[model samples]
Target: MFGPRRAVFLDRDGVLVVPQFREGRSFAPTTLAEFAIYPDAPSCVARLKEAGFFTVVVSNQPDVGAGRTAREIVDEMSLRLRHAMPLDAIKICCHTSQCACRKPQPGMLLEAARELKLDLKESFMVGDRGSDIEAGAAAGCRTVFIDLGYTAEPPPERPNKIVGSFREAADWILSLPQEDS
Candidate 1:
């Protein structure tokens, strides 16, 4: 019999893709033309999947909810990402307000856990923002923060590890000891 599955929840912008930076802050690309995945992302995700971890993307694309960007464009970017990598799923929250599915709340992770039969305790969340860390921490998973040195505030909840790139994060996660069944 198999035990519960482990996962790595990745934040879309900054973690997997390059985010637009201006005035010392990070921003998601509003257009597909501006959207581009980090060169190392696909291989890093492949490494995690090879190590028996499910790779899921949990993102907050508020531009959609705010009507600044069309939902179809975001969907297209997701579809492109799926074609480029071996992701198990992508969970996006387009709400601009304080909603349950948004990060800092853990709704997306929790819902993924329930639907994917994931073992939260053994899972990990990798992101470049405070809310991502908070969400992972709240969902009972170890968090990895990719310190891009954005002008925004640091994660209020400490992450298990801090890395400079997705490659480093993947290496750190792979270095952990495996749990016995």
Candidate 2:
């Protein structure tokens, strides 16, 4: 149960990866060779960890559902990230349905709460898309958006906060009253 308020949800693609260019209807990095992490993300997560926030990755990987990517590849990507940065957990919603685990849904965050014993109110979700924000807000956590300009349309629902980069969002969090803690 997410009780005493302790957790942060993150998205992997645009928020973490630098995001290679795509023509249309596709922009995700197609290979492990292409995956890259943001420079300041590690320190940002470290700060949250120092502040008693269990950082978890809440992502939607429908590639498995549609057969564009394999489950093992995605798992490897997550593990590669684990080696690259220190995160409490990496959660993925492989289903293509309106499943609760998807970004537009709160399933992954809720699942993280169940597994990690988080406090939803104290947690935050940082991602690069509107669904990422919606999921966090629906789960009752503050949301942050890292814009990559891939989204072709406006957000149907907005997040609690928006920032140009993860470091900016991290700086904003650090400026908060709880930063020093």
Candidate 3:
């Protein structure tokens, strides 16, 4: 019998979309106009899917909870993302405070694994933030950290791999040895 399916968990901002930067900190786009998906994002997701890995997006969008952005706008952005990529699932946590589903807690990744019937040990998490790396590690997934060189936020301590762009991240994942079916 086959075990649970493997997945690639991606952080929404910086990994797939061009994040808005203010005071050297990365932030999710509040308006649709500011939300721009990376040109390579769609193709990379397609490659992962074709490789038999579920492409899932796990993101933390705290702006909505902070009242800086409306939930409707966030939902619209999510809809646009779904239209742009062939993702298996997109899980988002909009909490401003420490919550079960927030990054660095691994709740989102764990929840996705349960709902998607994925194997956490066989999955990979790609992100550009420390919280993302921490979450992936807590969930027992290998991590890829995209180093965008943000000045305000320090780089994560350790990631399974580090790269410069989403394309590179995808390439690294593709280069890994696959387990026999």
Candidate 4:
């Protein structure tokens, strides 16, 4: 792996699909029936693939640890997401705020960088939350924050770019200077 490939690390819940909302808060789908892939997500991922980027999904599913959802359901969702899109890998953290692999920690992204032989500097992380941006920055990847207007608080850290949807995120990544292998 002398010349590592660049990756686009995606957050699953809000970035790939419409998150389930209740009482003004967003939650992951706990069941296969509730999993809904956004209309543009498949094409957005396809575009990233076409642009020579390895697309990986890094997600936090804390409900499983909290007993709000089952691990099987979470696994099912991951399977469905991978089946629906052109993802190279899916990394999930199911622990409730106590694990290093969760968003805001960069463990998952770091793991992917190691396992996939990725160049973090040439990578981009796309997510709709501050934790996602923080994790990407910690992992030394450029961050793309998808602003869905769900939070009043500013991002935990500044992102390299902020866009309104996954489509725009992919476009931004494509616009960057291509890294020479």
Model 3 C-alpha lDDT per residue in residues 1-181, reported as the tens digit of each score: 2644899999999999999988877889989899999999999999998888998899999999999999999888889989999988889899999998999899999988998888899999999999999999999999999999899988999899999999999999999997754
| Candidate 2 Cα RMSD after full superposition onto the native fold (Å) | 2.7
| lDDT (10s digit) by residue, model 2, range 1-181 | 2236577788888777666666532255657787778787788878877767788988888878888878888888889888877799999888977876777889899988988877788778888877888888899988887766655656536676778888887777666665322
What are the Cα lDDT values of the candidates?
0.93, 0.78, 0.92, 0.88
What TM-score quantifies how close candidate 4 is to the native fold? 0.93
**What is the C-alpha lDDT profile of model 4 across 11-82, one tens digit per residue?**
998899789876555678887788899999999999988877889999999989999899998888888888
Off by over 4 Å in 4: 1-3
Pick the winner on lDDT between candidates 2 and 4: 4
Better of 1 and 2 by TM-score: 1
Shift of residue 17 alpha carbon in model 4, Å: 1.7
Model 1, span 94-120: residue lDDT tens: 999999999989999999999999999
In the order shown, the candidates' Cα RMSDs to the true structure are 1.3, 2.7, 1.2, 1.7
**In model 3, how large is the Cα lDDT of residue 77?**
83
State candidate 3's TM-score. 0.97
Over 4 Å off, model 2: 1-3, 23-26, 179-181
Clashes of each: 0, 2, 0, 0
